[model samples]
Target: MSSLEQANEVYNKYGAYELMKRGISEGLRHLSAPYENLQTEDQWVGAKYYGNFAGFHNNFGGNLAETKCRTASGNPPQIETTQESEELEAAMELRHNGYTKIGNIYDEDVIDEVVSRYNNIIENKEHTKSSHSNDPGDGNVYIRGIDSPQEEYFPEAEQLVTEKVKNILRNYYRSHIQIRNLRAYRTHHIPPELMESKEVYNNHWHCDGKTSDHIKLFVCLGETTEEDGPLHIMPKKYTREYAKRNASFDRETDGAPNNVVEEHGEPVKFTGVAGDVMLANTQTCLHRAGVPDEGRSRDLVQLYIAPSSEPLPENWIDSELEGADPNVWSRLLKY
Candidate 1:
C-alpha cells in the first residue's frame, strides 16, 4: 500500500471519532525516519504536517522586533447596531479584512446550556485531557469527535447559523453553505508554572491554510474579554499581500520576512461577549489566540467551511472519520 493508503488505514481504525487521537502515536512512528523529505512527499499539509506531527511552528523566531503582528492592547472592539445593519456591516468587514463579528446570534439561554456542558469536560481534571499542552498561557480541550458529552448539542446548535448569516458567508467562502468540518473547543489560560515553560510557539502569528480556499466561523459560547485569550487578526488586505509574497510556503514552519512584517501592521483583537458569531477567512489573514492575563476562562465553538466543490487536500480527520458509527459515537458522549 502507498503511504496515503497506509495512512488511511490508521484513519479507518481509530480515526474519525477521536479526531487527532492517533497524532502523537503516528508522529512518534514517523520519527524513526528522522529528517523526513517532506518536500518530495506527495501528501498535503493535513496529512504530512498534522498527521505526522511535524513541528512546523517550532522554528518560530521569538524576536518581537522582527514580528509584523502589531500588538493591540486596549478594551475589546465594540459593535452596537440593529440586527439587519449588524449583518451587513459584518459581511462587508469580512470582505475587506477577512473577518467579521455578529453579536447575539444565538439566544443567551442556549449559549449558557452549551457552556455548562463543556464546563464539566474542560474543568474537571478526571474527565478532561488537554488536546495539546500549552505553556504559553493558552490551552484547549478538543471536544469534537472524542469527548462529545451531548451529541445533540452540536446538531441542535447548527440551527444557530440561521438563513441570514449563511447568505452573508456563502459568497465570500465561494461554496454552498455546508458544515465541511466541525471543531468545538473549550480553552483556558494556563497556570504560571507551565506557562513559563511553553515557548512562543502559538502566540506567534500564523494562518491556517496558506493560499487555500477556507472559511472558519467562531461561535463564542462564553465571554472573550481583552484578558481572556481574545483572537487578534490582521486585516484581509495585509494578509493577502503577505500571502501573495509567500504563496505555497508553510506557515507552521516559517515566519514573515523582515521586509514583509514591516509593512503588515498590528492585528486587531476581537473580544466578543457570549453568543457572538465571528467569521474569518482562515487562509486570508494571520490570527492567533492571545494569552489571557491572570487565569480567565474562554469557551468557543469552531465551525469550519470550505467551498463544497473545492478540492481540499484530504483532511486526515475528515477522511478517517468517514464511516464513524453515529449511534456508537453518540453513546460515548457525556452530559
Candidate 2:
C-alpha cells in the first residue's frame, strides 16, 4: 500500500482526535489535521481559528470534497532529523538575520546521480521551439520523473532533498502555515542570454495565490550563478504594488506583465548554489527566471503547500472519491 493508504487506515481505526493529539504531542505539531473532516461546514469554520483553508499536504483525507476530502498540504513530519544539521542551522540564522544561504544539504555524489539521469532524457527541444511552451532560455527544458528514484542513481535519497526542504519550511512557518506538495520541476531550457528574461516561457509577474496561500520553495539543482541564469524575486514590500496590475497565474492562460519597479531602485536577483531553496511568499512576491546560458544549466524542484481552511475550486480534478492518484482518472472522467 502507498504511504497515504496506510495513513488513511490508521486514521479510520483510531479517530482524528487521537491522531491529532499524537501528531501534535510531537514537535511535529505542524502535521496535525485541524478537523476530523473538512467537508462539513462546521469543520471548515473551525479551520478559521487555525487561519487559512488550504490543506498542508494537498491530500486532505483522500480527495478534494465539498463535504468529503482532498490532498495533504505539508511534509511528513515523522521523517525528519533528530536535530537539524549545521547547514539547516545556518539557513535559520540567515532567515532570521534578513537573508542567507543553506549549504551542503546535497553531497556531490547525489548531484552526480540526479544529473546523470537528467542528462539521458530527450531534451524538451520541441517544447522550447514551440511558442506554446517556449521558455525564454533561463534554463534547459527536460521531461523528468517518468521512471525515477532509480536505486543506482541515489538509492539512499529517495525523497531526501524534498523532505529536507519541507522540514525547513515546516520549522520556519510553523503549524500556522500548511505545506501542500513537493514535486521536482523539470525545465528544458530558459530563454535567451539576458539576465532580464523575467518570464522566459511564461509572462508577467504573478504568484500562486489563486490556487494557494502557502509559500513556494524553489530549490536549485544546478549552478544559479549570475550568468548561468537564476530566479528573480521581487521583495515582499513590492508585491501589492505589482499584483495590482498583473493578469494571469494559471499556466493555461496568458496576460500582461506587471511592471514592478522596486522603491530601492533595482530588481532583486535570487541566485544560489545547488540545494539552496528560495522560500517565496506567493501572496505578494513576483518572481521570474533569469535567461539560461548554453554553458550554465539550471534545474529546480519546487514545493507548494497552504493552510487547510481555504475552499478548493469547485471543479478541481482531484475532487473525486477514490483518491487523489491519477490512476483513478477513468472514474473521474465520469464526473
By TM-score, the best candidate is 1
Highest lDDT: which candidate?
1
Which residue runs of candidate 1 sit more than 4 Å off their true CA positions? 1-89, 125-128, 133-156, 173-175, 190-201, 242-264, 309-335
Residue 276 in model 1: lDDT: 81
For candidate 1, report its TM-score.
0.56
State the lDDT of candidate 2 residue by residue for 58-143, as single tens digits: 22321332111123333323434445564356336433422234544666777666655444431532212222344344343422
**lDDT at 68, model 2:** 18
Encode model 1's per-residue lDDT on 232-334: one tens digit a residue. Answer: 7777677555555544544334442222433547767768877788888654466766666655655676666533332223222333212211121111120
Cα-based lDDT at residue 275, candidate 1:
76
> What overall lDDT goes with each candidate model?
0.49, 0.41
lDDT (Cα, 0-100) at 150 in candidate 1? 26
Candidate 1 C-alpha error for residue 113, in Å: 2.7
**Residue 165 in model 1: shift from native, Å?**
2.3
Model 2: residues with Cα > 4 Å off, grouped in runs: 1-101, 122-158, 161-166, 176-179, 182-200, 241-259, 262-265, 293-296, 307-335
